[model samples]
Target: MKILDANDKELMTVRKIERDGNTLVIRGKIFGAMPMVARLTPKEARAALKLLDFKTFFFLLTLLFRKG
Candidate 1:
């Protein structure tokens, strides 16, 4: 799955989208080999990055668990 920006630019390739508490967590492979951290917004997830840790968690999981 792919995430596109407002202009339709590819932001990240997603593996899964999960909800944690009042936040939405996105798990995916990013920038080739880097672990990316991005948190979901309370209202609009795409608006800001409030929680960085959640993003890191998802990133690691996707990196380690993604099947070849």
Candidate 2:
């Protein structure tokens, strides 16, 4: 998954996603910035999903629609 700014400039990229026991590990790098990795439990992931802003959701939806 790619994270973009309002101008559609790449801000970050989700390079890898994996399951670690009951947790989800995400690896990525911010464009022109340092790398980052995060581990989230199922509950944390759910909570993060619930916190997604409308614009981000719309961006993702648009990307999906474009692929189809």
Candidate 3:
């Protein structure tokens, strides 16, 4: 998955996601340069989850299974 900045420019390309204990590890790159990792604590994870409500969750599911 690719992350875009506020200006819609490429910020980072997520390479992998892993769970470490109570943290969610996101491995990615910035500007296609050095590797970067984001460790989201449980609190932060919950905050992020709030951004993906039920309707959005189902939308993502549909997109995932949609045929071109």
Clashes of each: 1, 0, 0
Q: Write the per-residue lDDT of candidate 1 for residues 5-66, one digit (tens) a residue.
A: 79977777887788878887877867445556566767775434445578786786788677
Highest TM-score against the true fold, candidate:
3
Where model 2 places Cα greater than 4 Å from the true spot, the runs are 49-68
Better of 1 and 2 by lDDT: 2
Ten contiguous residues minimizing lDDT sum, candidate 3: 59-68
Q: What is the lDDT of residue 32 in candidate 3?
A: 88
Candidate 1 collision pairs? 41-45
> What TM-score, to 2 decimals, does candidate 2 have?
0.61
Per-residue lDDT tens digits of candidate 3, residues 1-68? Answer: 99889998998999999999999899999988989999999998788878998999888889978885
Each prediction's TM-score against the native?
Answer: 0.45, 0.61, 0.68
| lDDT scores of the candidates, listed in order | 0.70, 0.87, 0.91
Q: RMSD in angstroms, candidate 1?
A: 12.4
Q: Once model 2 is optimally superposed onto the true structure by TM-score, how far is the C-alpha of residue 23 displaced, in angstroms?
A: 0.9
Better of 1 and 3 by TM-score: 3
Comparing 1 with 3 on lDDT, the higher-scoring candidate is: 3
